[model samples]
Target: MATSGRREVARRILRLTDGIEESHEVHEPVFDIKDTPIESLENAVNPLVPFLPDIRKHAVTAKKACKNPPPDGLTLDESASIRLYSMEWVPHDKCLYVVLNDTLRSEDGEKVKPWFLYLKLFRTAFERLPKQHLTELENYQRAVDIGMHSLPSNHPNFQQWKKALESAKEN
Candidate 1:
């Protein structure tokens, strides 16, 4: 049953990401790993990007929604390698069910370096989703606690380019 559920989730994710066109540039609002203080995008988003191409597609879909919803049957947890990531309820005692498709961004005739770097960025962005969402949730809670009923004016995530700056600091 878990396997079936995972497969269904993968199918839905695929459908969502399949909307991106090859001709147009998709403006994805990704957490800029370059400026993020983290050592590497890999450190920010591990297991999540295990299969790059797949995750890239989902990212495109996520961009459309402007939200980061975890894959079905998955739960966020602290992984030693990533500040925050998730482990799905894998059947047969496996740890993860999603496979990030890292190869989708590569050109048919392109060299390997760009593909490698892009995939790295993609993975980091994927991993950063949980952290960002958690931070947003925390910010929301903080706002509620203080009776503001809205994000604080100085809320860390409210500004443009905040992710890049934060990532740079971590680095």
Candidate 2:
């Protein structure tokens, strides 16, 4: 597949996940890691280990899977960290992305402090990925198509994004 096609597929996959709403306005300053030094994935998300079960194991497994990888000029650790964040824990609520997304969207920005180190690694890793471009129309079409084919409508969360997208189209 072409680079843009791969990107659209990945975008559609992300859309299927429980992402934060785009309209949520933040009143507090965002924590960034522009000047922060890099750290191991374990150390980055260690603070969250107590709150999230099996996260350490998940990180270890993810790192092992990507040991020899070099995706888009990133270290193996960066690649594995991204993979770890994407991993789904047994309980849907315990998923790393789900929790992190919730923390990021919290009304009190202070709640996001614990995630600073992990966010720095996550965002930095994503930023280092190679560019992939596609038109908005193509992106939208692919999202719908992917949802229709990959996610059965009978699924509980299917209606969430499906209806939202339909409603958006009507407006």
Query: For this target, which candidate reaches the highest TM-score against the unseen true structure?
Result: 2
Instruction: Give TM-scores for every candidate, taking all chains together and pairing residue i with residue i.
Output: 0.19, 0.64
Q: lDDT tens digits, residues 1-171, model 1? A: 999999876754443333233333434533333543433333333334543434433333333433223352122221222221132332412222222222233333232333344344445555554444556655644544344325455543333234554674454
Candidate 2 residue spans exceeding 4 A from truth: 1-29, 132-141, 144-171
TM-score of 1: 0.19
lDDT of 2 by residue, 115-137 (tens): 77787888788767654312443
Clashing pairs in 2: none
Off by over 4 Å in 1: 1-57, 67-97, 101-115, 123-171
- Clashes (backbone N, CA, C under 3 Å), per candidate, total 19, 0
RMSD of each: 17.5, 9.7
